[model samples]
Structure formats: structure tokens, C-alpha cells
Target: MPFTIKCPLDNLYGMHVFSRLPLHEAKVRYLVEEKVPSMHAMIELRSGEKVRIHFVHPAPPSPTENDESTERDAELVIVARSVADSDEPVIVTGDLNDVAWSPTTRLFRKISGLLDPRVGRGFYSTFHADYRLLRWPLDHLFHSHHFTLTSITRLPSIGSDHFPLLTRVVFAPSQGQDQEPLRPDGDDRSWAQDIAQSKNANKQDVP
Candidate 1:
């Protein structure tokens, strides 16, 4: 499981990120529709370096909600492309809706060139807090190669269905120098375009 599972949106307009660091720059970027957006924040560390963070919370596909993964997939594709074009220590994370190992999430990882710390680590599943057996890792955090993972773990539930997650990383530009980013294949490109065009980009076959 590249890492998450699908479900209905109990609170469609819910999700937030907090930081104690000084924000050098920040903005909300829309995906598909203005109401559905992601937060792009640039933080200035004490070392004088800046890390670009993209916090996303695309709605999930369910019988009563999106029903189809079109908008959700397209949102991820849009963010992935934007993150790909950026030249900085980026961290793209949030409740990605789909599972990590799924084709859609894998494509997002490839297109954005981010690295999943959970690649060889445990799942640390975070959904369905009330039922441990039914939980899955629906929430994710993927960062660029510029930083080294200090720690990542799932926090106990705070009365929410999904468990909160906490992670820490230290910037080490040297670590990124020797790392390679993930790249998408032809089929991945075609599928991404099809999904994006089906909604906000250009009109084409639906994925």
C-alpha cells in the first residue's frame, strides 16, 4: 500500500497545518475549483534557508460525494506539476485521499519528484481511529531530497476519525546533492493530462 485508503468526507471543508517558525511567504492555491485549495507556505529557518511547503486536502471520492476520483486526481496532478517546477526544499503533504501504493499517488510522487519517508518504513496507518482493524494510512507527507528525516510517527487520536501525524527533518543540502528524484513514464503523463483536462485544464477523455 503506497499508503492510504478511500472514504466519505465527514467534513468536506476541513484540514489545517500549523507551524511555530516564521513564515517568509504564504498563499492559498486553488485546485480545480477556488473552494478546493491547497496552502503553499515558505518558512525561513534560523539558518537562513527557506523550505517550501504545500499542504493539500483534496476531497475524497465517495458515493455521496465526488463519486468519481476525477477532481481529486486532478487536484493532485495540478499540485504535483507545480511542485515539480519549483526549485526549493519542498514538502507536499496532507490527506491525499488515495492510497500511497495506488497508481494515482505513485504518479503524483513521480511527477513531483518528492521522496516518501515511508518507502521502507512501517505504514503508520492513520484512519478510522475508532476501529484499529479498519485503519489505513490515508494521510501523507512527502518532501524533497534537501532534508533528512529525523522522525515520523502517528499520534494518538484526539477524538477525530483520523490520527494526527508528527514529523521532524533537518535540512542538509549535501544530502539532496546525491539523491535522484522520481520521474513519471509516458502512460503516467497521458493519464495525468487526461484527468486534468477532464476537469480544469483542457477537455479530453476522462480517466
Candidate 2:
């Protein structure tokens, strides 16, 4: 299965790219050239698959004359719903411009219920390799718990400031097919009051 997808970050350097291979089994391809809105797509091997995709970005606060400007890229969210009785796999890969440890990214991982293969796996710097201390891992591949991580690798820079990441993930039969709780229910009113008190305390602490 082959299809074309427009790049969300048009004219930006170091976006993801794809090519066909002859040795592969079944494959669904994505093309990221001159695309828009930073697409998120899922291809079902057959029918009755639950795959959800979302492209996201955080808009910066309004800039002032004294502030520096920056461009924020979109974060792709791909959800692969399990087949009813089949053991086929689902995979999602992309360049998420956000940092791995950012709160927004964490929330995304939680909401999407996707497990990052890079976690517990060693960190490999991908962005700003030239700057030793300032580099960070920006690209990511996240999968559901049903998927087992074979390998995750950071590749050499392709003439771009950010190097690419290649990951091999496989879907395995679930030992126990059960959904985990998303989050515990909390009192919104109490939480708001707590936040307000904390803010006032911080104000008192400030010089």
C-alpha cells in the first residue's frame, strides 16, 4: 500500500523522507514533501482497525521587542487500534520538534496511550550535534504496549543540523488484553484552590 502525504513543515530543513524497498513484506508508505498542516495517517492492513492520528504544535506567546522569536513545529499523534482477532502490528514514526521530556509531550503520550521505545533505552542526541552541551533528542517513535521494541537507533546527520532516528518495532500478542486507567479522578475545585494558594505562597517567597 502506497500513498503520498504533504509535509507539514514546508521549506523547513530536516523533515522526514521515505523511499521504497524491494526486500520488504507488506508496507504502507508515507511521503513528506511540500505537505501542509503536518499530516497524521494510519493504514489498515485489512479492515476493522482502530488508528487515530493527530498533528499538533504549540503556539508561542506574543513576542515583544525585547524577546527573541522562535518557530514551533507540529507534533504528530498516531493511534493504532488493535484488530479484533488479528495479531497484526501498527507503527507510527515522525519528527516531533518538541523535546522528549517536555510536559506537553508527556501529556500527549499519556492521552494517546502510547509507550515510547526510547524510554529506558539510552538517549541518543539528534539535534544540534555540533553543540555538545546544547544537543537534545527531538525525533521519536512511540508504540502501544502490545508492540515490542526490537531496536531504536539514531542515524548520522544527512547534511542537516538534526540527525534522523530509525526504529524497529514489532507487535506481539498481548499477555493480558486489558486497558489501564487513564488518570485518577480528582476534585477540580480543590485543585484550583490548591493552585491559588501555591501561587500566593510563591509570590510571598519572591524577592
Candidate 3:
């Protein structure tokens, strides 16, 4: 099934990109409301298997009105939950609003247990067609443990300023043995407290 993801707030005049992917029809899915500029959903195969689709985005951070760090952390929560507790395969695709090399993206990947197909695949910038030096990757498609990446490509620049990314991924067969259940870092109070503290500090300095 072919699907497209675009940031609703992005304009043709702005440096934003749209990501698209074509999946097999055998995958089952239930469309979810766009929680953020991005969206999330559930995907399943004909064998009654299920996977999760997580789209990443948040109301754009206003430098004049909001703390960028806090805004990013808030977005991280949504992205973290999309794959935090799933045993099934996951496909997270969209305009992340952050560059691939950003520290926040690295932390998110580690916390969510997701893998970036673009790593070691060469740097492919997807933003700012008007400024060559300002371009960076804002669009991405990340996968989970249950899937193996086949190929990834950046398509020609579309109407948006950013180039889209297309990734092909296949589900790996299960060993059928009892495995350890997947769980989130809910008990990790230290990290959660640190994030909370950082957000609060940023908010306090805003005024």
C-alpha cells in the first residue's frame, strides 16, 4: 500500500519535505487521526500479525513564543510511545522536524529501540532547496527489530523544498520460541526526572 506523509503546516515556500512509501497489500492497517502534523497507526499482515506505524511531528516550535527544547521533548514522547512497547515490526516515517544528525534524534532512536536505515547509507539532505549550505535531512523512515531493510532512496525534489525518502522493508520470520516481552522505560525515574527538569528549566527562562 502506498502512503504519503506531509507536514500540514509546511508551505511550498518553506523548506519542508514529504515522505512516501509503498507497502504490500497484504499488510493490514487502521488509519489513525493525525495526532501531530504527523500521524500513527497499526499495521498487520495477512497472517493476523500486527505492527505499528508512527509519524513524528509537533506544532512547530515558535522561537518567539516557546522553548525549542521543551517542544522537542514533548514531540519525543509521542514518538517514543509509537514503538516503546511493541513486539511487532514498526515503520516510523514522516518529516521529523529535526535533522538526522541531531542529538535529539539519536537519543530518540536509542530510547525507542528503533533503527535508522539511513545510518551508514551516506548523508542525504532533504531540506532547503533555496540554500545549498542550509540543507539537512528532515524526513526519515525508521524501522524496528522485526524488519530488515531492503533498500532506501531519496526521490527527486517534489513541490516542497525537501526531497522525499522511500524505504523498502521486509518482515523477518519469527523463531516461534517464547521470547522476552517488550517493555518501556517506565521505571526509569532518573531519565524521566531529568527530562522534566530540563523542560521546566527551559520554560522558566522563556519569560
Candidate 4:
């Protein structure tokens, strides 16, 4: 089957998604051309079901990167708003550049109303592929309640700074319809609004 690599044009640090399924409405978002871009699209499964997917890799909170994570938080909130608005079964996976248990990531889950499989489960850290002692779960996958996790694992290193993340989810709306997404509180809503409404796009999305 043919596959598509959705990434930022001429940028090495942008987010990338490789999918064999038929993808439509593919678009890439980024605040900085030198930073990882966020890519989103719709994929048609074999059963004719459509799933919305987003891939993100915001700049890390280093002195040379996002500094205090302002852009990172903004980008995440933007994506969260998009996901929350989506009516289709959504799956967002990416190297978020933030820990899974961080406040930003928590807000992302709440704002998006997505379910995290990592809860109750141990932290499946993936960063520092070479140094096991300094690893963190910077990569994550959050999805709608229309599915259930079959398995999620941190795979062996693939020659990158972060270990590969492998996830499998089964679509069974009947089984997951009862699952409730994390509700954002008043404070969470206010912060999410502040980020989403105040942040302006520094770069246009890719076609």
C-alpha cells in the first residue's frame, strides 16, 4: 500500500506522520520554521470509519528553545481546541516535549476531553534513548472515548534521542461509549481560553 509522509516543507525539525491509510485534509501547523510542526489529517480505515489524527512536536523548554514554554503551551492549547471541536474519533500522538504528568499535558487532556491510557499505568518514558536513568515520557497519545487501548509500549531505541512509542487501540464505540473524558474545570477553561485566544500563529499551516 502507498503511504504518505506529512511534514513541514524543507524543515528538518517539523513533526512527521507516516500513514498507509488514505489520508485527507492533511495540514501542518508551526509557530517557528526551525521547530517541529504540528500535522493533522483524517484517515479512512478499512471499515470505512474516519479517524482524525494530529501529530505534534513543540519546542522543548530549554534555554535555547521555547524558554518558559509559552509557545509550547500555546501550541498545545490550539491543538486541544481543535481536537475538542472535532466530531470524529480522534487520536493525537506526538513528542510533546513535555512530561506526561506535567500541568501543561494535564491541561491538554482536560481541554481536549481526551482519555489517556497512561493513567494507572506506569510512566512509559521514551526520552534519552541512550540514558535510561534520565528518561521521560515526552511522547504521548491521547484519544477520544470511542476506542479502547489494546496495548501501549515504549519500544527499543531507533537511533534517536527518544525511544519509539508503540500503541494499539481498538475501535469499539459500544465498549467505550460509557467512558467519560476528563472535564476541564473553571480554572482550566480560563487558562485554555487565555492560551487559545491570545496566541497568534507565527507561521501559516502547510498544505
What would the per-residue lDDT of candidate 3 be over residues 15-114, giving only the tens digit for each residue? 2232333323232111211233444445556566766675554434566434555655545643554355566677776676678777667666766677
User: Which residue pairs in candidate 4 have backbone atoms (N, alpha carbon, C) closer than 3 angstroms, thus clashing?
Assistant: 15-37
Segments of candidate 2 deviating more than 4 angstroms? 1-3, 8-10, 13-36, 44-92, 175-207
Each prediction's RMSD over C-alphas, in Å, is 6.5, 11.1, 7.9, 2.7
Angstrom error of the Cα, residue 112, model 3: value is 0.4
lDDT of 1 by residue, 36-142 (tens): 66667687787888898777788788987687888888888877877777778888888988887888899989988888888787887888899968988889999
lDDT of residue 23 for candidate 1: 69
Model 2 scores a TM of 0.56
* TM-score (C-alpha, index-matched) for candidate 4: 0.90
Candidate 3 CA-lDDT value = 0.56
Better of 1 and 3 by TM-score: 1
Q: Flag the better candidate by lDDT, 3 or 4.
A: 4
Better of 3 and 4 by TM-score: 4
Compose the digit string of candidate 4's lDDT tens values, residues 25-65.
88765643345677777888889999888777777778675
When sorted by TM-score, best at the front, the candidate numbers are 4, 1, 3, 2
What digit string (tens of lDDT, one per residue) describes model 2 on residues 46-102? 344444333322222245211211222112212211111123343444555567787
Which residue pairs collide in model 3, if any?
Answer: 1-23
User: For candidate 3, what is the TM-score?
Assistant: 0.66
Cα lDDT, model 1, residue 87: 78
